[model samples]
Target: MALQVILFMTHRGRTQQLVLRLLQARRLFPEDRTGSRTRHQRIAERLGLGYQVSVMVPALLWVLTPALVDAMSAPAANGTAATRGTPLPVWAPFDLQRSPNYELVYAVQAVTNVVMNLTGLFLDVFFVTLMLHLTAELDVLNLNVASLRPSPVAPADSLESRDGDSLAKQASTDAPYTARGDSFRVRTSTSRFHMYRLLVKNIQHHQMIIM
Candidate 1:
């Protein structure tokens, strides 16, 4: 369960980083003067609008897992009278209330919970810092892209002009190819994120049952 959680968190971080890169690329390139959208711009906009919703799953799991574990391991409703009067099941490994090692088990559990909580807190802080940094970088990239412009020389039928026209035409036609590549990248990233999340959820369910 712990390993699965770690994997989930790692994938989530990767996805966030990919989104940041997409945003940076979009800001650096901006849209064409012809009013056409770039591949980076479309992907960045889609991810920026929807990525926050995906984060809620991990955030909720981080907050709720320890509480769920504690609740599952809580003493039975029949209470101390039952614990004192009845013998543990023959198949039981050890009785939580009667075992001499009970304190040690509880200490370990408490420490584990503390470690998990601290890890979650660190992840939250890291994500916030990353977002802020990305925002600043994005603003700077936007300024740079906006300041860039074509040379002021008038068009002509010279070799230099023909070469320039060909380059422009090539760049315009490459947008579809760029869009296709971006679509593949975005799909792969999102699929991996969702896959890890689902695995983590399954692991959580299993851990709850075991507890």
Candidate 2:
């Protein structure tokens, strides 16, 4: 646990950089028309919730086990009761045998345990969500690449016939390829340029994911 905390603190910059790269890739890539982005998002949420439930349920049970056992146990036959112990054993300066002190301390310990569990849950969920997002980005990149059409000849009056205007438009749009029939159809050389540019972006995104 100490090592985990130390690693997290020491590698905070790396985590931030990874998140930034993922976000940048997502923002710069084209999304699928089949509503995959939404589907992947929902899957990520469900997985995160599943992780929270799976981890916290057991943790809560473990934290409360001592209290539950104490409540369930029978008293001694000699008119004496079993001494109740704290959920977590910790040395204290003041006596914990008294009324408010024991209850307060027990409550504090239980709450602290839950909070620490939640902290671990947050870290787990963070990595899980990032991985889900990266997968979604890869899906989009694959879709774009698969949808690339053959380089067809452009008409004389098409956008490719124009000088810099077509290049400017291609540079501005993130998707670049518009949907047509089975694949992304190109009317001009400008659209071909867009396809190649998008493919390069996809390659770079894959490299980042690998790194």
lDDT of 2 by residue, 23-63 (tens): 77767664767666777889989999999999899989977
Q: Each prediction's Cα RMSD?
A: 18.4, 8.6
For candidate 2, report its TM-score.
Answer: 0.73
Model 2 lDDT vs. the true structure? Answer: 0.74
Question: All candidates' TM-scores?
Answer: 0.30, 0.73
Model 1 collision count? 0
Error of 1 at 53 (Å): 28
Query: What would you estimate as the lDDT of candidate 1?
Result: 0.45
Q: How displaced is residue 30 in candidate 2, in Å?
A: 2.8
Pairing residues by index, what is the TM-score of model 1?
Answer: 0.30
Candidate 1 lDDT tens digits, 1-211: 4674687577996656556664554454443343233333454555544554455456556545644664567577877433322111223366655555544454455566556655655555445544554454445344444544433332222212212332233322222222323443112122343555555544543332223
User: At residue 148, what lDDT does model 2 achieve?
Assistant: 80
